[model samples]
Target: MKKIEVVAAIIQHDDKTLCVQRGPAKFDYIHHKFEFPGGKVESGETGEQAIIRELQEELRLDISKADYFMTVDHTYPDFHITMHGYICPVESREIVLTEHIDAQWLSINELPQLDWAAADIPFVEKLMAE
Candidate 1:
């Protein structure tokens, strides 16, 4: 089995967290699931670098800083992922959605109401506790 290592940006503003829906999935289980926007940590890049790059490419938002939050290791049916999460506050700019199908800034209490990727559930749970 292949292991995927990635970083997720838990971007927040004014007490709300940004969540984006996956653009499309060939697999039914993953389609439309809400998630923090981010991408894989390419070789030779730190988690911080990865999230910064991913956000810029995926959302067109500049991450001023990414503070470490939590890490999640999850095994799906076909792959496993070790994900590093960071609490990223963006620079003042409008978000341009480039990859996700939809996005919403939801209250922490409402975070769990939407369908989320299996790997992101623990991160969301941990966030709600804060």
Candidate 2:
């Protein structure tokens, strides 16, 4: 199985977290599912750097810094993933979605209502538990 290293930003602003819906994928399980905004980590890039760059590229959202959060390791039928989560505080919820189909800023309490990708569920659970 292929292993992927990814970073996710739990972008927060005005007491809401940013969730982005993925576009169509080869796998039905993940397609169109909501997820924390981020992408894969490139070789030689730190997890923080990866998140910062990914957010800039994917959402056109600039974040000065990201605090370290928890890491989640999950395996799907096709691939395995080790995801690093970050707590990124932003000034605004505004974003230009270049990759995702839709985006939402929902309170922690409301996060569970969305259909989320399996890999992202752990992050949601942790956030809602807080």
Candidate 3:
């Protein structure tokens, strides 16, 4: 199995967390569902670097700073993945969604209502529990 490293961001603003709907690439399992914005870490790239690049590519914003929040280790039949999650605040609200089919800003209370990626469930639970 291929070992993959991914970075996910739990971006928050004014008590609302940013979530994106899965696009075509992720349409099979829970298509169009909410998830934290992130992608696989590239070769020779750090998790932080991948997250920053992905945020810029997907949201069109330069991430000045991001804090590591959680790390989730998951194994699938096809691949093994280690996802690192970060929490950060963007400079503005003008997000240009280039990859996601849809995006929403939901409160922690609302998180439980939406269907999230399997690996993201624990993070959401943790956030909801706090």
RMSD of each: 1.1, 0.6, 1.7
- Candidate 2, 67-118: lDDT as tens digits: 9889999998999999999999999878999999999999999999999999
Ranking by TM-score: 2, 1, 3
Worst 10 residues of 2 by lDDT: 121-130
- On TM-score, the stronger of 1 and 3 is 1
**Residue-wise lDDT of candidate 3 within 9-69, one digit each (tens)?**
8888888889888876533555666788888889999878999999999888677788998
Clashes of 1: 0
CA lDDT, every model vs. true structure: 0.90, 0.95, 0.83
Show model 1 residue runs off by greater than 4 Å.
91-93
lDDT of 2 at 34: 98
1 or 3: which has the higher lDDT? 1
Show where candidate 3 strays beyond 4 Å.
Answer: none
Q: Write the per-residue lDDT of candidate 1 for residues 1-130, one digit (tens) a residue.
A: 8899999999988778899999688867778899988989999999999999999999989877999999999998888989999998754536999989998998899999989999999989998887
lDDT top scorer:
2
